[model samples]
Target: MYSGRVRPGGAPGVHELARLVVMKGVVGPLATNVYVLRDRFSGDELLIDAGAAPDRVLALAGDGPLRYLVTTHRHPDHWGALAAVAAAAPDAVTVAHEADAPAIPVPTALAVSGDGDRLTFGDVSVELIHLAGHTPGGLAVLYDDPTGPPHLWTGDSLFPGGVGKTHSAADFTSLLDDVEAKLFDRLPDETWVYPGHGDDTTLGAERPHLAAWRARGW
Candidate 1:
């Protein structure tokens, strides 16, 4: 029963899936949403987007064994607290797309380049789907839960209303095409979307507006 009602200053919310658990909190000056996913049985954990506020990130990580820290994109606001979190948990492997690795100051121990790159922890498997536009190496994390709907964590590539911002029409087209084919085409409507900076939504909620989003040329 994830309420999907998190805000910058509000309390964090936790969602439980079949074999995994996710705790979400909005942190940093930009109010970026940080997600801490843990294995329900093994208690091993991985974090998505340190955002900022190291103390808050560590607190959300809790006492579980932090196995990995996956950054969705190359945005500064997205991984602001990555260095601190990685330092705190030296064992946690830093993961990011190879294309954007140069932009991120922190060293990425595991640079995933493929679309279906898998990061397995305990019994849970997370897939990294690359969506280029907002950034050449931007990526979206997909966790197709065994017992529930697929959960997608889109960094800045997508939101509740439309795809992430782009600098030009070409950039917008790149992002839109990738999002549509890779995400909308493959995943079901019930897939839950966890964006970088706002409330949660489902792909089904935003599917009908694909044409509108494209025509706007944003």
Candidate 2:
């Protein structure tokens, strides 16, 4: 039975999920986290945020049947390895929201996904939350699987110590408001946040920092 649920402490019971590998990207001179979630039971896998260092990502991927390369936004740092990934996993479909589709350099098998979209492979499913403050088409993948910690892949939107920057006035204001309401205000105290950069943190740990960041007018 599907037993995924958002739990306290950001930790979910993930024993049945097979395995998850956190691949650190090398390009952009920034630490980009690429998640490779596999259905240990069936050997099928899905890649989330194929950023930097194609060779590292491929080596970590290790010749598995990749189901798809899902991007979090159109940013180069987040999708830098798209062409390489697509070339290596020729059959894998690349999914992204319509808003960021054109900006993505490579030819994408583009599937339109927005808020509440559910992506699943082998029994693992993640609820897509549209967090637009970081970028016009930015998205945070929220997973409430029964087997692991409840995770919010905040792609440059929300972070451990701060929020994403907006290049325009409209983008910035709207993003700040969105983060306050859609993200910070909605998640449970224990939600584990995996942002586009830096180390991971929990909702409880970040809530106070959110207040501090808001005060900075960032």
Candidate 3:
């Protein structure tokens, strides 16, 4: 039976790009998808959201020295294994948006602000787009690969069918507004969205339902 959740023993899959390679693995009781992005040329890597199973996450990283551990938000599901992963890579710098830095359990060595801020490792570069509402400092990592469509790691902000769950109408509005302006309006429809959980989707697939999502007021 398909429960729509990533269960334990779910194998990590790899997507290779011209300059980067992404390894996706599921962890945590919430089934958070932890992504390990590596620069093909330099072998530099970045781990996004160490949510659970430190051993599994570390194994997927292989022998490469992790340069950055980026926590998209302060949610427990996103950082469940953060401490263990950080301990494994003692030299890796922890990164988070300044707005949510104080809430992060681990020490954030780099507090990023503004959409223009970019993080680079070897030839791979990722642009950080701050999308609030899901969390005050929720960030979506954008990788503009020359070989393929742009890749966006949205965390819990934007998902396949709709936006992430929000507690209030105001919060939902804020998230929807940010997604439309910063993501859908600016990026191409072909852009690939790898969310915090579940399967991946494209912006094009979800573009038409924007109005429907708003009408329901979820």
Candidate 4:
């Protein structure tokens, strides 16, 4: 269960996953979450959402080869440290959704569109699920761990309560629709959620409240 999982409020920690060593840290005024996933066998690491505090983020990555730097959306808070991280780890391939790529300051070397687009770093397979609404190109990163339950990294698109805040009802509808069809409907209850900010939650924990979330219209 997630009871043992790190809530990540102000403290930095590491998640010893089956195939990867996930170094999770907090950064910036917004206190966004940054993850350094190192492939257990290959030692290749992938940094997710270099939110802010480049030095701290780089420190979490350590002196080594960072393979990929991926931004989950176009939100400034999510990519505030993107450029800095990219420059520091020039060898790391940068990735983001094609729709949000242009808005990101640094040029994304790999632009992925959500139709079965996947990235591999050692044995870990990263799946990109486009979930709009929080932003025009919000994404939910899924890692189907072969050894255990699937792990999901939902930027701002998802949290324990409902979908991320949308500017309009239409945007909310779009986000909810994509989240249901692409996320809740397909993923199992055991899927672990790593949100952009705040504590982590599983699909099972949030599934029953879907209707309530929809009714709230947020």
lDDT of 1 by residue, 108-139 (tens): 99998869898887778899999999998898
By lDDT, the candidates rank as 1, 3, 4, 2
Better of 1 and 2 by TM-score: 1
C-alpha lDDT values of all predictions: 0.92, 0.70, 0.89, 0.86
Query: TM-score per candidate, in order?
Result: 0.98, 0.83, 0.95, 0.94
Residue-pair clashes per prediction, in order, are 0, 10, 0, 0
Model 2 C-alpha lDDT per residue in residues 92-204, reported as the tens digit of each score: 88888777878899776855656777777665677777767667788777777465557677878877677887777677677777877877788787777777776667788
**Predicted structure 3, TM vs. truth:** 0.95
Which 10 successive residues of model 1 have the least lDDT summed?
1-10
Q: What is model 3's C-alpha RMSD?
A: 2.7
* Candidate rank order under TM-score: 1, 3, 4, 2
Cα lDDT, model 2, residue 14: 33
Report per-prediction Cα RMSD to one decimal: 0.9, 6.3, 2.7, 1.9
How well does candidate 2 score on lDDT at residue 16? 35
Q: TM-score of predicted model 1?
A: 0.98
Candidate 2 residue-wise lDDT at 87: 95
lDDT of 4 by residue, 1-218 (tens): 22324443455677788787777788888878888888888888888899998988999899657988989998888999989899988889999999999999889999987657787887678888899888888877888888988888899999988899899999999999999999899999999888888777899999999999889996
Q: Of the candidates shown, which would achieve the greatest lDDT relative to the real structure?
A: 1
